[model samples]
Target: MYFVDTLETEGLGNRSYLAGGPGGAVAVDPPRDIDRVIAAAARRGVPIAYVAETHVHNDYVTGGLELARLTGAHYLVPADAAVSYRRVLVHDGDEFDVDPVNGLGLHAVATPGHTPHHTSYVLTERGRPLAAFTGGSLLIGTVGRPDLVEPRLTEELARAQHRSARRLVEQLPDETAVLPTHGFGSFCSVGRVGTDATTTIGAERHRNDALVKDVDRFVADLLAALSDIPAYYAHMGPVNSAGPRPLDLTPPEPADAEELARRLAAGEWVVDLRARTAFAAGHLAGSFNFEGKGRLATYLAWLIPWGKPVTLLAASPEQVAAAQRELARVGIDRPAAAATGRPEDWLRPGDHLRAFPRATFADLAAVWRTGARPVVLDVRRSAERAAGRIEGSLHVPVHQLHGRTAELPEGSEVWVHCATGMRAAIAASLLDAAGHRVVAVDDDFAVAAAAGLPVDTSDEAG
Candidate 1:
């Protein structure tokens, strides 16, 4: 029987797929690492016949070229992609037979909005629609933001995005699965869409806010809701356009304590990927903690200077491997060195291990009631803060905190927080490193609001 299996790239918050027929399969929107796709096809006892890319992705590097070369499959990309490679450049409405004996086929439908050349694929068996690989368009509850292309074309593409989303629902069967390549916590989505894993054309029509009949409002809200694009995104286009080399996943050389200290002294980034609370408890001085389980790639890529060599620091070899894989997704291949162990063990004379305090929302509320003055630094994004924030809390989105540190009152006591404690830990580290008395509010946002803390929405959250 033919079936479609999802391959999740969690750090990037996107998904790739392998659709297998009788003896062959097709991979769609694959990541730079092709091992999982290869393994899935091998388990299905099928050869990969084709690799399809929905667009020239700006989110992450594609493994299409490498996967095709490794598996001897045809690489399919949009005809208008201007890619510097040789393969099947498909146009709208083109169809390919994956394995005719099993009645499996792939059809390309031009759905430009996420980019000028975006395409969505509909999976068919015996000419009946089974699912649509709606890459960066017609997502589970939202469509891809249309501002990825040229600034001038943003509005034009937004209108097209609305039309394309409607076309998917109008043309496909109501029961056809809507497997989107984006929208699963990816920055590609215009706003926060529900993470419900199941999706269908009928469900989207009934529930997806972006799919409302009013195209004008959809366009307006989508364009307006586009927050800051990640700093690393600008480079993804050029790399994917020109083409990228096959992934090299070999472990980088391990750095000993002295070596790490030397690298740190030389100003190389050594990002610690332990949990936030663990990181705050005790960490190597000059290292940044971005919690490996969290959005390591997104935040690290955003903060790291472009083209800088990074040294990953983690607790276990397994964690270093995981952090390495996540880094490669954003094309941060080949760390200068990766070290795994306690920061205290890496200490030397004048090389310090630092720790910070963590507080609960209730503790903060008690201090506030006593009129104890600590700048409640709300480090969430502006959009999140605009929803609601602690009254009188200073706002500096975590991503902008590094550069905007000077804006924060010099040496002021700071209690930093985000929706959850992950970002709060990051903000706390930044504050502590800047010589401020820092405490992380290590609890949920709801806990803070319910603790009888003042909350407001009209405070010009900047």
Candidate 2:
């Protein structure tokens, strides 16, 4: 009956849980930070029994395998699941009995549809269900979406998801405590679930809009709200399926401003790990402004180049230390140093370094209509463009921009746009340094569409 919930928050929030008996515990859907889970297990004076995943996750990087390797725990997934990892797969009706040792038992209920082989765990204290950990299969207020696949498989998957939700509703008791793997803000849960981390099945059954007993409508509602899933989702799925790589928890130290400047010249990204407000107020020219103060490590791993040397511009010494810890969570080991003083002091006159002009979607559209005729560089990924893109824009993803410099005319003025401002800013700076006049259009397409600019759509989109 011992249960622990770990919440990971940045732009995307993920929750992982450790639940089990006395001698050994089981980790369910552990996040990329395995140290916290390991530390918690050490505090409880128990060895990990197994690291279990409810389904193949498409959001945050899964840390289950790392936990398994670090603690010598078995890695478990649903039986017959087509994943990349070597695991002890459990099937429906499979019982993980810990009763003989610690008075707890776990039963695996095959609940497909979120993926091909999703499972829900029913924990029992004395042959009675106490809690159910429904991974992505069911959230607090919504059921798993059935249409994550291609159009050919969307309906099939949706139907399977519908049946899965109905099966869980039919089998599980109303009063059973329910803990889902994701919450609000998760790309996986999207708009279906609310923000709360945990709730009872009884509460969900009564309050959940998607679980209203009209299965077809439930499936339709879930599918209709599906937007373009983040590339990180599919990117992390294979990582989870195979097993999480161990992250180095010790982040490197910061170099002085001069040294950081040298590193930046050497093609390193000096990420300012401050807040956007801090970045907007004043920051080192050319510093990428993700400033993920809290989940600094997560975004560092996600957006910035992995294992690349980083120069951190933290607000304080404590913030620097916190940044180091966060980076270590995801194995980003090389952080060069904090700037000598405030980030502003480093911005001296005559430094060709310039922050790109940031514009909202509406503003950019207006600029596009002007006679200036700036070259619009769509810095979003090709997959994102498949959904919809601004017309007459050249495709140059941020990752490939540095490599494809030859494609750009050296003196041409470039206007960059991504789904958001973050990538666009980064791309604009790269273009600027490479001798192109660049500006950043920092708005979502909705804003662009509202401005009545032309939008091109394609079938390959999300």
Question: Counting only residues 3 or more apart in sequence or on different chains, how many pairs clash (N, Cα, C under 3 Å) in candidate 2?
Answer: 6
Among all windows of 10 consecutive residues in model 2, the one with the lowest summed lDDT is 291-300
By summed lDDT, the worst window of 10 consecutive residues in model 1 runs over 453-462
Q: Tell me the deviation in Å of residue 384 in model 1.
A: 0.6
TM per model?
Answer: 0.97, 0.72
lDDT of 1 at 383: 84
lDDT over C-alpha atoms for residue 68 of model 2: 81
Each prediction's RMSD to truth: 1.5, 5.7
Model 1 agreement with the true structure over 1-462: per-residue lDDT tens digits: 688999998878899999968667899999988899999998888999989999988889889899999889989999999889898988999999888888899999999888989999998998899989998998878888888778999999988988888888888989999988888888998855867897999989887766775878877788778998888998888899999987878899999989988998888887888998788889888888888999999988887888888998888889999888888888898899988888777777676778988999999999988988678899888888888899888888898898787888776778899998888888787777667788899999877778978877565645
lDDT of 2: 0.68
Error in Å for residue 101 of model 1: 1.4
Cα displacement (angstroms), candidate 2, residue 391, comes to: 18
Q: Model 2 residue 269 lDDT?
A: 78
The sequence of per-residue lDDT tens digits that candidate 2 reaches over residues 1-462 is 555555454445556777776766778887776777888777777778878888877666667777787788878788766677678888998887643465677788888777778898887776788788888777777766655545677667766766766677788788888877766555566345766656877787776755664767766676666755543354566666665666654535657656767877888878776655455455566576655544344344555554567777766767666666555534454466665457655654555335445677777668767854667788776657888877777887766676686797677777778886767766665665566776667677666777867787867432
| Candidate 2 residue runs with Cα over 4 Å from true position | 1-11, 83-85, 99-102, 146-151, 256-259, 262-268, 294-311, 316-341, 344-462
